[model samples]
Target: MRIYAVINQKGGVGKTTIDVNLGYGLAKSGKRVLLIDLDPQGHSTTVLGDQGAELTVKELFESGSKLGIKELAQPARVHGEVVENLDIVPSNIKLAVSAENLAARIHREKVLANALEKVKGDYDICLIDCPPTLGVLAVNGIFAADRFLIPVTYARYALDGVADLFGIISTVRETDEFNYTIIRNGYDSRTKTTNDFIEGQLEPFAANVAKTRIRKTETINQAAINAEPVFTFDAKGNGTADFEALTKEVVGLDA
Candidate 1:
């Protein structure tokens, strides 16, 4: 499978939002997609409308080879008989504590990679929404992924934190874990700060960045609050068009 983890060390950068919508966008284009929510916040699960998320990442982590990832996947909240190609492994708040507890164990950084190995090629694309921390679990997320994406919001961020995100990525490379792409998100070019960040700082980083940006839009906010991907909610909106572009970029990657 071509695994891509939608990751960033910062929260509220639209990581989960992008993951769900992009998964839907890709599925709409006929790619078999598997999206895993590694964020303990479970925003992906919640936004996807998974009220009764049967098995979580925690269950899968604790399951090891016992449960098997094929059986571990459940249809996303937005996924039904209609979107049979899209799958989700949900998450919950308990994962935060599970992560802390798992840290005390061996192979904590290898757990996710090992789990994913069980279902290596079951999907054409595996996208993971990683939590906003560089914990063992997050490292495991990177280790398991083949390629990844970093989402950054257009606003005042502690430059140190952005640097820290790259630091972690460098560490992943030092270990030869995975190569990744950084996606610039929530870019409101109207704002002075956003524009400055996009032009002055981020533009130079384009080689590591995505070709598209999810511009600031109310459609995205409304879609999240309604617990549905923008594709299922408003496929004709600008948000859907942008994500459709992202889907095309992803699909074109190894072609």
Candidate 2:
């Protein structure tokens, strides 16, 4: 299966939003999308609508090969049958502890990749929502994935993140690292800062920048609060349109 990690060393870039929404958008195309929350924050778990997805990534690492995708994954938390094709491996704060406990072993890099091997065939795509730091767990995440898809916020400091994430990518690729792509996440055309970021900065680092820029919209933000996707919440909004355009570039499908 093709796996994409939605990652950035910096936070507040709408990383989780891109992960859940893109996974949901892919699912709408009839692709079976599996989303993994590698972040310790459990935002993906909450966003997926699994109130008690109580299983965290920490437990998975501790339990080793005994853990199964069915045991770890919860159906994404969207209203209606819109999420029928979506599944999620939830996460929580404890993953940070797990990372620390497992760091001594060189084989730790393959832990997540090994865990995912069990159920990789069931999905057309797997999206890992990584934390905002270049820690051990995030290293395992990059090591496990087939590709990288970065989401950048429309802010001034956003340009400062490329060097760190790129350094990690180079380290991973020295092994069996996968191909990478970078997509601009939350964009507002009216903002000069956003324009500066796109033209003056991100254009140099992004491997695959989609033609569409996810605009700032309350509907997209509100949909997250409602624990649903913009497509399911408001299909006509700019958020849905931008992501739909992104999916086309992602899978080369018309859905």
Candidate 3:
């Protein structure tokens, strides 16, 4: 399976949104997708409306491979029916404590990698929703993922923590293994400042930026508020189209 971590050190960059939608999009295309919510905030779990999962990522981390990933994963549903080929390993506030404990353990960075190795063959793709900081949890995600996806907002300040994230990834794996993509999120085509920032500041990373930008839209939030993916909520909306395009681009890239 191809595993990709949707990460950015800055919050509110739409990392969780991208993860849920991408997983949904890929699953819609008949690909088995597993989304792992590594963030203790559990925003992904909230967005996907997956509740009452007895075994969360927190428990999986503590138990390691003893509790198989398949057992820990719960189907992600939309409109009261399980979405085909989509599953989630939910996370909750307890994950923060697990992450702290992992920091002091031996082979800490490889903990997540070891856990995922046992069940990697079950899914076509695995997307990890990372925390908004470069901590032990994020480090675990980086090591487990084969590729990284950084979502940057239109604001220039959003680029502030890119270097720190890249530095952390470089230290964990080889330069070649640092393969990643930058997705421009919350984009506003009407703003001149956004255009300038993309052309001047973000131009250097042009090759890595996604061809399909995630535009600012109320439809995105509405779908999340409804606890359904954009495709299930509004099939013809831009939100659905954007993520579908992103999933195609990601799946096209070889792991």
Candidate 4:
């Protein structure tokens, strides 16, 4: 399985949006996608049409290998069978408290990795929505993922927290062993600031940036409000097309 952690230390960069949409897009394309919501906020869990889940990702860490994937994972569905082939290991506020104890355990960084190993064979893709900080939880996420997909917003200080994320990657694993992709989210070509961010701030890391930028669109918010993917909620919209292109780019890179 290809495990990709959708992460950003800086909040409100659309990490949950990317995690849900990409997982939905891949699942719609006939790939079995499992989304693990590691964020205590549980935004990904709610957006993917799952709420009040009996089991969550925190239990996997607390119980360790005792709780298997089937026990923790709940189906990602909408209106019964409207959208299928996607499962989610939901998250709750308990995860924030669980993070404290994680550091005290042996090989704490690998806790998530070990939990994922038992279920990796069941799915074609795994997308982890990490917390918005470089804490113990995010550290566990980094160790578990095969690659990192970063969602960057267009702002003057867009690259501010990127150095901290890279530092974590450098410290834990071989930087080259895992690939990193930077996607420009909430992009508006009509704005000069967006253009400047692309040219001045993001240009230095051009090699890692995905060619496709997730353009700013109201349909994205609409989809979230409806608790469905942009593709399913508004297939004709630009948001769907952008994410489809992104999914293709991600899959091609894996190839």
lDDT of 4 by residue, 1-44 (tens): 98998989998888888989999889888889899899998888
Flag the better candidate by lDDT, 1 or 3: 3
* Candidate 1 least-lDDT 10 residues: 75-84
Can you write out model 3's per-residue Cα lDDT over 118-176, one digit (the tens) per residue?
A: 88789889999999999989989999988899998888688988988898899877564
In terms of TM-score, the best-performing candidate is 3
The CA lDDT at 90 in model 3 is 91
lDDT of 3: 0.85
Q: Which ten residues in a row have the lowest lDDT in candidate 2?
A: 49-58
- Over 67-113, each residue of candidate 2 has an lDDT whose tens digit, in order, gives 66768877776653436889888787777788788888768778888
Clashes of each: 0, 2, 0, 0
Residue 195 local lDDT, model 3:
71
Q: Lowest lDDT 10-mer window, candidate 3?
A: 59-68
Model 1 C-alpha lDDT per residue in residues 1-255, reported as the tens digit of each score: 888888878777788888888898888788888888888888888865363666678875663436656776887656443466888887888788778778787767777777778787777888888888898768888777778787777766723376676678668657634466767677676787657765567665667677887878899889888788888778799888889988899897756
Q: In model 3, what are the clashing residue pairs, if there are any?
A: none
Candidate 4 least-lDDT 10 residues: 75-84
Choose 3 or 4, whichever is better by TM-score. 3
- For model 2, what is the alpha-carbon lDDT of residue 212? 70
List of clashing residue pairs for candidate 1 = none
Listed per candidate, the RMSD to the true structure in angstroms reads: 2.3, 2.6, 1.6, 1.7
lDDT for model 1 comes to: 0.77
